[model samples]
Target: MLNDRYDNPLTTRSQSARDAYVEGVDSILSANGDGIGLLQGAVQADDSFALAHAALARALQISARGAEAVAAITKARALAAGISGRERGHINMLGHLIDGDGALAYAAALDHLAAFPRDALIAQPLTGVFGLIGFSGLSGREAEQLAFLAQLAPHYGEDWWFGTQFAFAQIEVGQADRALQTIECALERNPCSAHGAHVRAHIHYERGETEAGLAYLGEWRRDYQRRGVLYCHISWHVALWMLERGDAAAAWRIIDDCVRPGKVWGPPLNVLTDTASFLHRAELMGGAPQPERWREVSEFARQLFPKPGIAFADVHAALAHAMSGETDALAKLIAEPVGPAGEVVAALAQVFAAFARQDWTESIALLAPVMATHERIGGSRAQRDLLEFSLVAALLKAGRPDDARLTLISRRPKKVGARAVAGL
Candidate 1:
């Protein structure tokens, strides 16, 4: 068995393969696209490298190559028969994740970490995909995520990546001061950490610090590679902040330059959904997005529909189709089975559809029940704000000024003026 940079066991006998595998893990921790190639190199260097294959499966899974991820993990499982306990745990963790059993994967990761605390591969599942820190099905995931990270501090003392992940969980749980300090420490260790930068963005967004958020991303993104996993999503943050600043044109410019359909990097599903959401939100604000843009997103959504178990993606797809005037496509997407997590997304879709028809009362009714449950769909507090915006807008349009005023007063930041209510 070979060991990773943190001295975690890897089921690879070849030294070159081990090095490539470690590099791949590091790339993933940094959110670099190079991780995919590095992990592929590891497997190429040694076909029997079970741990490398497992890690590669995770990378492929995040990249939306679901079939390839299944193949890679299947190969990993076959080779795992002879690996050490730690390596087997890694394989098990990734295998469960590939199988879409997030709870099982998370359980395996917890067990793996208890035995081998330095295994960052095991830790990845608790952040990126069905992460406890981000979009997780577990109730009170934030508190559990923070407690878990705190418990692991002794195992990963002063590690930059751990700090970044911990800081993100901190931000989610309303520990902003600690999150800021932790992320700053992480950035001090490696300024190029895209994950740290992302956490910082979340910190700003959650606090409603729009200008600080913009300046931070503008400076940090100057050095961030567009090919990385987070560039488009981070750019989406910038666009959102620009909208918050009342610079609708600036928001559209960022979308056109970095996040628009056919122009952005990262997963097609993620980029197109974010682009479509931005366009729809802009239109709601009375800022005109080019109709062709909506059509482009509609085309992308059509390609991804009928595979709608992920609620976040489904909600965005519905937005794309509805905005583009593809009523038939929208209805078909709504009718697809999205599971319980998708329930709120489906309701939000109905809200949008009703709002489009100027049926404000129906829109308000559809939106009211889903507002609290929207978080169950696993987007950031920032991403889920789109749903809140819809609710407020529908309330106003329904002539429920008292209700809209109460919503804005309770939910929106005190800094924002009447423009948010004035349709941009």
Candidate 2:
């Protein structure tokens, strides 16, 4: 007999249903399995309840049931048709979860707001989706998204989610100083926002404050664990930091504990495979014990390279060959033509191979054009950093000290770490 109090029905039963929906939302946030079951029951009883569907979709996404999450979001959108105010805003938020392309999701949210002018729920998804888009390496798209969100920031003052996203975008465009300022503002407004903390940790990492970055990540991990959710992206960043510091064993342990078991929403398997490949290369550089996991990851990469949507797999495979001293394998990978981004990665992989072989001249030759066109190279800052470091190292090893010094001077102001110094 329960019905939503806000619905057409005007009775105690409707009031009870409204209370149930509220309880369901709270339960899902608290990671209660029974709460999700109750939400399903409530949605079955009232197919027009948009909140219940959106909440259910969020839970499903957290559980890694992407297809089910999409279905739930579809239902929520249908139920929210012609609705305005918070209900429509919630629908837009759920739309972000279902849309794979970040730009498309932002557009859809903007369309929803064109109808509902004073919607508060729009801020949460807009910020989160924009942050993820920035990570996907489209700086232009990220700037546009941030500008759109900034227009609403005045009306939505102290929005921690939006502030964190703005910080993340700043980091993407090599503006670490601005990113640090924005993240500090976010933490001042909401110290409990994990995304804000994660951004702050990266800023610290970029500044070569490795210990501070590790501490920040520790706090973020503990906070998410207490909330019964895991932020896999932060964990991945921690792993990378550890690898950079020549602690491959510690990096491997972090990935094994948090990422490999699928306990969290980590990167796709292929991406993790690439991380493992890099860790193996780090181990070789640091004289650490060879990890058996590297071979397993290599096999995974080999299987993944032939599949579409796994363009980065080629780079990982090439790195694996370079690390293992398999010149023939490396040559084959580098010789194969690829897209613009892929071509850059392939050229950079050749630099790694040449460096490993101590062929400094060939390494410099391979990397010069890539470095000259670095601005036009389409990939994340992380990928570009790898290529830039290789080029600087090759220039130094080839005895072009002046060119190496100039490259270091030009880039070191923007980036940090020994890789930028290239032994100068």
> Top model by TM-score, which number?
1
Per-residue accuracy of model 2 over 197-255 as CA lDDT, tens digit each: 76787677667676678777876666564223335556766776676666667877877
Assess every candidate by TM-score: 0.90, 0.68
Which residue pairs collide in model 1, if any?
A: none
Quote model 2's TM-score: 0.68
Give the per-residue Cα lDDT of candidate 1 at 283.
67
Tens-place lDDT digits, model 1, residues 1-424: 5678888766667999999988888888888648889999999999998988988988888787899999999999999778888788788888998998877887888888988888887886786423644556444666777888888888887788999988887877778899999999998987888988999998987777888989999888888888888888889888878887788888878898888767856677568668877877676676755668878887877776557767677788777777677898778656764655666666777777886677989988888887755667676666666777777878877788888878877875532452554542
What's the lDDT for residue 18 in model 1?
A: 94
Runs in model 2 with CA error above 4 Å? 1-47, 58-64, 77-82, 85-106, 113-132, 135-142, 174-178, 226-230, 242-249, 260-265, 269-292, 301-306, 310-384, 396-405, 414-424
